[model samples]
Target: MGTSFEKVHDYMGRRVRGLWQRNGKFYQQLLVEQPDGQVAPRRILLKSTTLDNCRIEMAQKRGIRDQGEAASEPLEIPSFAVCCRRYFDFHESLKHGLKRQTTIDRERWSLNRWQVHFGHLRVNQVTRVMINGFMQKRLRGGRNPRTVNIDLINLRQVLKYARDCGFFTDQERLPTEGVKPLRYKAPVRPLLKDEQFGLLCEKADSSANRSGPILADFIRFLGFSGGRYKESLRLKWKDVSFELRQVTFGSDGLSKNGKARVVDFNPALEAHLRIMHARRAPDCKYLFPSPQRGGKDIPASDLRGSLFAARAEADLEWVGFHDLRHFFASYCVMSGIDFKTIAEWLGHESGTALIDKVYGHLAADHKRRMAQKVSFSLAQQAASPAEQPAVAAVQQSPSAVLPLPTQSGESAATTALAS
Candidate 1:
């Protein structure tokens, strides 16, 4: 940093606050509150050379920009908490700000903890050692690597903002630079299989209560459509179009992506919807009305308790709502539906990338069944290399029943001929 700047004085010869001169022009630094409610500095070129001109311009600019905040003092970089608040307030204005409300909510939650950890420290006071200690403490406190990384992320967002505010300049070592994010090993949960699905449905079907059949239909809907927990609960009767073979999930704050989506109906999804439609309450709009809502017309908040009971009775207590969702995807894949189409049905934002990452692998029998669809013959060589490459693929089709190297020995033009 420069040791000094030529200071601007008032007409009465008193040094004016936050007025500096460089290259025969004056600059005025004004204090203003950011949209998210953090006070920060904003500098403006005064275009003034003399003290009278500088003072007059400064007063005029302050009247236009500054709100009712206190007079500007010597511009000092605010504390970490201030910088954090500033960043969060203006996050929407940032080029790479958080797009999803859920992400913003999660990041804010993470930063709240961080604020209590180092809120009092100046931006420059937060060091790499403190960050490393916080990481260890979070891990020791029973947070997984992924959760602890949230804290690290929130901390770095502020520090990076501080850097933009002119704190760490000229390739300085960042607090989170050497700290490596721990590799996240996602724990595998139980997936519903064909027999387990039947067992659960049987338990629901055999239950001795009004909620039994409803619960059975709910499970069927989830298995058939891959609807998320709340999305299914929020589903309405009008959203189903049996004629169109489509079910729509409108944006009702329950969708994971906060947008409406339509799931194309398969045979099972259609059958499940028709069954539910026959028994749906005339007074209610939701597909799954609350099991307890006798006279009240409302959607079921959750069916976890009912699901748990059903799972226990069926001796498949490890099953969850997401297991059925997985079952739907797996069922589609086994039926030979492409992943891109599955992702759209599942309301995924990354198209097929997430589906392929999570649901790509399947049972060994299924893999073998898919593999058998490919065929090859090991006994022959081609008469011509060029001819072989073109015809070989057609010959390798598993549908081909060859009596010779590349011939099926039957023609459509002559079904049967006199030999």
Candidate 2:
């Protein structure tokens, strides 16, 4: 018989050795010959408990090698659902600190949506066609491109985790390659007018919710600071400097960007914070503590119903809590605050790109006023003798006579010469 069919431990560029564990279990260690004739060992647990069965399996593997066939079944790829669980666990195990609970919840929701369609499919089976189909399905279900892209982002992360775990060796297994996220233009978020904001606050303060006043003040605080909804809620009295009129969002404050930033307050906001400080419970660590739970940060859900109710009462149903922040940026731009200053106040680390994208469009009134100011200044400058062409023309044409009014008894030429 050929050496390939021999019951020897090594054959055809591969070898299998029996390994006995201390617990009496047997394993098959596969040694594959490298291109340079070096052997690389890979240990695989044996399903059979006895060493005889392991030898039999090894002989079978040797027989397959003799026939030039693969000695084992293809490696099993994990399903999308399994990959998502593993991904979440991996993120949870990171030492740097996991994402916020709300962010994880959002990821869970997005992954669940993906699981509904691709859970049974192996991670390697997700192709560009499958991803495109998912995008089409989401669009048909009335999801916007931006919303659909968020799901894609979550899916991509899961696939990347799978790749990192050695579930796939082929680059094509990752569907994110040619699969482009759908593009959609976002509408400019509207800002509340001064009168509308005042009315909204008035209605919010008088609403049936016992926390109505607190909610109103919270909205005003967001407007003044231009802080994100969560950032504002995470504020503590210690972060505020009454003497310096500044509020610092530091590492302990849970800023979105994970960096420290200081925002200066106007005189109005400083006074507002001082008043709230006086009414704050001494034990409360949060600036906006929940009325129901003293010393605890206010829950976002607590104010949703009241905010919508107040908006309805003020006849400004289009307004939202985030709009207050937008209102601050919009008015800042309109009032001639530079984009850099606005970006700093908003805790943006990437410079003014965001400000220019969102708040660069000034209000019509602001644009008109600016145009008028420019026109008046230019008109005044143009009226100066140094700026006029008439003086230059007269100097260039010495023979040119001024057309003088014929004085009561004087001729025109004589009147001109009187100078």
* Residue 137 in model 1: lDDT: 87
lDDT string, candidate 1, 171-201, tens digits: 7777787888888988987668889898899
In lDDT terms, how accurate is model 1? 0.76
Where does model 1 exceed 4 Å of error?
1-78, 82-105, 123-129, 153-179, 206-211, 363-365, 370-419
List model 2 lDDT by residue over 23-112, tens digit each: 444545566543233667644455676656777866665555456565344223557877787677777777775685567779999999
Error of 1 at 17 (Å): 8.5
The residue pairs in collision within model 2 are: none
Error of 2 at 330 (Å): 0.9
lDDT against the true structure, per candidate, is 0.76, 0.73
- Scored against the true structure, residue 121 in model 2 reaches a CA lDDT of 84
* TM-score for each of the candidates: 0.66, 0.70
**Which candidate wins on TM-score?**
2
